[model samples]
Target: MPPVAFLHTHILVVVLFLVFFAIKAVLLLLNKRDTLDRMRSKTKIVDIVLGILILITGGYLLFLYSGRIPTYLIVKIVFVLLAIPLGIIGIKKESKGLTVLSLLIFLYVYGVAETNSLAMNKEEPSVAPITNTTTELPVKKAPEEITPAEAAQEEILNAMGETLMANAKAIYTQVCATCHGEDGGKGLGGAALLTQSQLTLNDRINVIEKGRGLMPAFGSQLTPQEAEALAAYTITLNTTN
Candidate 1:
């Protein structure tokens, strides 16, 4: 199945799990022990099934992730693990404190996942000015004084540069646009704003090849030359703006 299918299924299972817990907690709070027990008896199999599906789908998504596992995602997983046992023990022992704690943790995890943050805050990503690395080119012979061979070589080099930039733009759109946006300021999923980046050209290439934080490594997907070209193109974004 496609990743989207698994994503949808995971969402459905999570909602159902939350609803089940909500209903049970409500009954417990209302002192409807008998009703809660009756519902639990009827849904024991469902509870187990939901737990399995959550783990299966969540694990699959994690496996599909191209980057290093994100911090928020790791934290969310830990909370989920903690909440499940707390919930089971709470319901089994009829402990309102434990049940409520478990429910709150589940809610917190949900928020973290939605915001892609540990603090659950969706703050705008800040842009930093890029450091200038330009240097004066060595003095070239006057155009009229240049040999025919040198002129042809220069022309070929210019064409190659343009071609690389075009390829880099296409690659960026195909692989990085979803998170970085077309102009590189979208910052979705914690992507760095390219226009605001402060890294030198070489540093940008390293980051693209190895990745940092939420960005996935493209070393396997992009050649070193391609990585260099992409880095060069990202620098242009800063200059153009």
Candidate 2:
């Protein structure tokens, strides 16, 4: 399949799954047992189809990231692995809690999928240097200490950051390079030479995300961080040339 088609199907299947789960969650919450039962009976085949598509499409795409999977994707994979059993168990046991939990999990995966970030409320903390230790052999500067747990988490985020830059490079090559040229100085696509662009980073992000005139809108095509990375990458084109 074409990259665009592959991406489109991947997105559409996941969105449809969310809608399917959301409807069921609402029914369970509203105590509409009879309605929920009827809908279940009618939608079983269709739901199966949706689930199959998600697995097939998702699995096919997974091969592309074997050595380069990002941290957020790891979280998403875990949730997707749980999704099937959660659905079956939730409806069979008529557990409102499980149903609600499933909805929230899916939403989190959605946020991570769309934004390419952990989407956690808290930021990962940086390592701090121990200061002013008493009885030190010397009054020298203290080396930074990173707890083992914090180090692992930082490693994951750093890998995620690397993944973002790699993605930005790919996006620039495949989407922007044709017009901006490899050096980003050519305007063959009638695009403003990215090297000469005076737009602020945010402005460039806005234009890329929303598009202007001949440019295509990437708001839905690229994640926010990916857009930001691409904006940053464009500036490097000038330096390289």
Measured against the true structure, the TM-scores of the candidates, in listed sequence, are 0.56, 0.52
- Per-residue alpha-carbon lDDT of model 2 for 1-241, expressed as tens digits? 7433554587788788778778887888999999989988998898889888988887766654324466667778899778667866897689988877777778877766654468643222132221111111111223366445434433433444555666777888898776566766545313556655556556778888977634667889888888877775664444311
**lDDT values of the candidates?**
0.75, 0.65
Model 2, residue 234: displacement in angstroms? 4.1
Judging by lDDT against the true structure, name the best candidate: 1
* Model 1 steric clash pairs: none
Model 1 TM-score relative to the real fold: 0.56
Looking at model 1, residue 182 earns an lDDT score of 79
Error of 2 at 106 (Å): 0.6
The regions of model 2 sitting more than 4 angstroms off are 120-241
Candidate number achieving the greatest TM-score relative to the actual structure: 1
